[model samples]
Target: MPNLELLRIVDSIARDKNISRDQIYTDIEQAVASALRKHFNTEDTTEFTVAIDRQTGDISATRNGQAVPLTLLGRIAAQTAKQVLIQLLRQDERGSIYEEFKDRVGTIVTGTVARFDGPIMFVTVGRAECIMPRSEQIPGEEHQVGQRIQALVREVRDTPGGVRIILSRSHPDMVRRLFEREVPEVGEHTIELKALAREPGHRTKIAVSSIDSKVDAVGACVGVRGSRIKNIVDELGGEKIDIVRWNESSQIFISNALKPAEVAEVSLCFELGRATVVVAEDQLSLAIGKRGQNVRLAAKLTGWDIDILTPAEFKAGVDRLDQTLKSVPGVTQEMCDKIVALGLINVFDIEEVGAEPLVEEVGMDADLARRVVERCTEEAKVVAAEQEAKKAAQALAAAEAASAPPQRDARDEAVLAALGLTPGRDPLEKLAQAAGDDAGAEPAGNDETAKLPDPRQAVPGGAPETTVHKEQPVSSADTELSPEEQAVSLPDSGRKAGAAVEHTEETNADTAALAEGRAEPPASPGR
Candidate 1:
């Protein structure tokens, strides 16, 4: 028979783990039944049965409708059964924990520090215990027993100790998981994070791409108002996130990786597996970053040996390094000439050889061999970077010039000319000259070789002495009417027929008047 106290323990454990009460009851009943059947040394137990009352927590074992014999020790046996039942309940609670977190691998979960198991910290995540190693813990990060924390599930495994749920906050997936939770575009199919390079707390560069051309992957991940990424940044305690756009073209991809610094040019030597990036003098410091971090990240992101340069420095470095390699003692003019033939023309070729082999093969002393290798490697880096920078600058300059505003066209030129504008001359000069000129005498701004005015503006027969006859002068009062007004009184076509008839009648009248006036003229004089 199961003890009443044992039933209470089972009920409490079920509540703690949120396991079903029926499942706990079934497990307990089976354990007790198997123990009873084994005690009787019987394989078949049709005559025996065990039952637990739901309301009272009373257990009864019967054989053929009669109670089982209860010795003084049998009472103790019931007590022992109760203890065994409590032990089984604890195991079932742990089993429930395994079932809950087994499917959460690679996901981020929150937990509270339960205890420290030596160097490893044990955290209670939902229902199970998670183990975090000292190495996986953030450096200088402190945790109290009840302080809440978040970590990514590294592994879930079963062991003699119990369910071992390994968790880590410093893992690369921790950042990725956090980003996924905060960014819907990343969680959905719209945008994907292609690759990630991280220096944990310092900084991280995530390469992102969009499946749809219209969707901006970086903008989506950054969220509207920076709220989404701000949440992630807060969760990570302010780790810097630099989101870069991924490209199939390595030149473009590397160019983008070095952010906040503009790449002036990019030149790729595919056979050498190297890319050179040229940046403006102002941007060189930003591209190389503090201690070359920016370029280092770019190198890892693009899988290329990135060399940064400014145009002037690259040409000088390449030339200097080339000359230095040629001046090395063991490096003969014949052998030096042959080295570039083997694609080893640069000072950096010596890095490909180890110190011992360099001495044996190139026949040089150890110290000299090492020095040559070191100098060449260092020089090669500067030279390569400078070359790349120069190339990138040229390319960027070309693109900018192409996209610049277009030049003025022929129509604009004609309009300017009609407005009396001159080409390749100062407008201020023309303005100054115009202010000092006379208006009525002719526009004096025109040079002596300028053309004459149109004749339409000139009065008829009033052109210069060389072109036409001068008209007789008329008093200003009598000449008030213009030529057009004077022509108005004449017939429409000004034909001679109308003028001839009027002239004949006037002439006969004048002749008759003259004859009559001759006789009366003597008498009219005295009157």
Candidate 2:
């Protein structure tokens, strides 16, 4: 009897595994032949033929030109057939996946996070589970299981285990794909993406040009009020994107690449493949960006090494080149200007270019060109040495400043000592203790007058004993008295008797203390 059920099973498998029906039928025939060989215990060299009908899926087998029935195969033979069929089906599925994804390399695809194996994430993309390794994942981005994510198909390989599909979130093409998706003009071929540079998770700069003059490439990519770019940024976890209009001119292109910073001038050195960009002093930081990221990405996008400088620096370089060239014998001022005009800005640039350009471009004699190069070479070494020395001096000064001990004011130390606070001791605790002592001290009088203590008297063996009077408050009547009368009413009789003598003695004591490196006065005992 024709087994239409067998054909139905094959079709179902073909649909589920994305394998061709013909391939599945071929696998089944091979499996049946293996089963017959196992059932008959035939030698390895013996051949068994099997065929399956594409319409009805009836199995036919022959051995030694005789018909054989698959039903006669025992349980062991059936198990062998089942194992062989499963292996062949898995191989076919793997091949199908490899073929489908291999062509998709560099294209974007969406998938669900299936699971994680250490730093490797397995995402279910279509019927295949692709892997996104840690290196390919965007920095600071984490994916949860079952979360939908989009990535670039970086690679596809057929291995012994199965098809290995590699996905990348950090690839620069991911941004290109995003633009194509969000901007209709880009996808429709009206706008074209020229170049892109990205520091994944931080920022990206893309250069775009429009085929049609009426449509603005940058404006379209940015959409109305940045509605288009906002989508790409949101998809990249809020990464900043800069869409600049592309230009065929390298100078104009580089200026656009470093947008948000106005360029004062751009000098190109073709031989060195370097672009020296000059911005106003105020715009230097903007041109350089945080940690030179702006200029770095600009270089990558423009395919030229970039050196950002201020107006003053640019002038200095031009002047230095002019001076160095004029210093060389047989080199005239006009030749110097011509050399500077050629974008040879400094002695180093002249030295790097050697004498050929000076001869051919500047119309200088070959021997004179050699002499000019030698002069520039020697000048370059001197300039380099001077710069290195200047850098060393700056570094040394910085190190000294960082390593120097903080200067302590003598007045502050005296105040702290008077307050009974010392280094490495808690100031609050010391102040509390002093407060407690003050609270314990008995009041001298209802109205007390305070006097400044003499350092000479406070010294161990410096001057004769002088009476120290407690401070007393002056009465209202005393305030009305003249200065002479107030002096007469002063309580310190010693100050009136020998004021000059006390001043001389205090001065001597201060001089002695200062000479002994003890300029800070000791705390008075009558706190």
RMSD of 2: 14.9
Q: Which ten residues in a row have the lowest lDDT in candidate 2?
A: 444-453
Clashes of 2: 6
Q: What are the per-model numbers of colliding residue pairs?
A: 14, 6
Task: Write one digit per residue (lDDT tens) for candidate 2, span 1-527.
Answer: 78989988988999899999999999988888888888888855358888787887788888877888777999999999899999999999899999999999999999999999999999999899999999999999988999999999999999888899999999999999999999999999899999999999999999999999999998999999999999999999989998888999989999999999999888888877989999998999999999999999999999999999888888988888788877777888889888877878889998899988888888999899999989889989999999999999999999999998666678867877887689546567888888999999976643444544676557676565555564444674546767887776645534453665687799899999988998976689996
Instruction: Score residue 393 of candidate 2 by CA lDDT.
Output: 100
Candidate 2 residue spans exceeding 4 A from truth: 44-46, 403-527
lDDT of 1 at 148: 96
lDDT of 1 by residue, 160-222 (tens): 778888998788788888888888878886888888877666677889999999999999998
RMSD of 1: 21.1
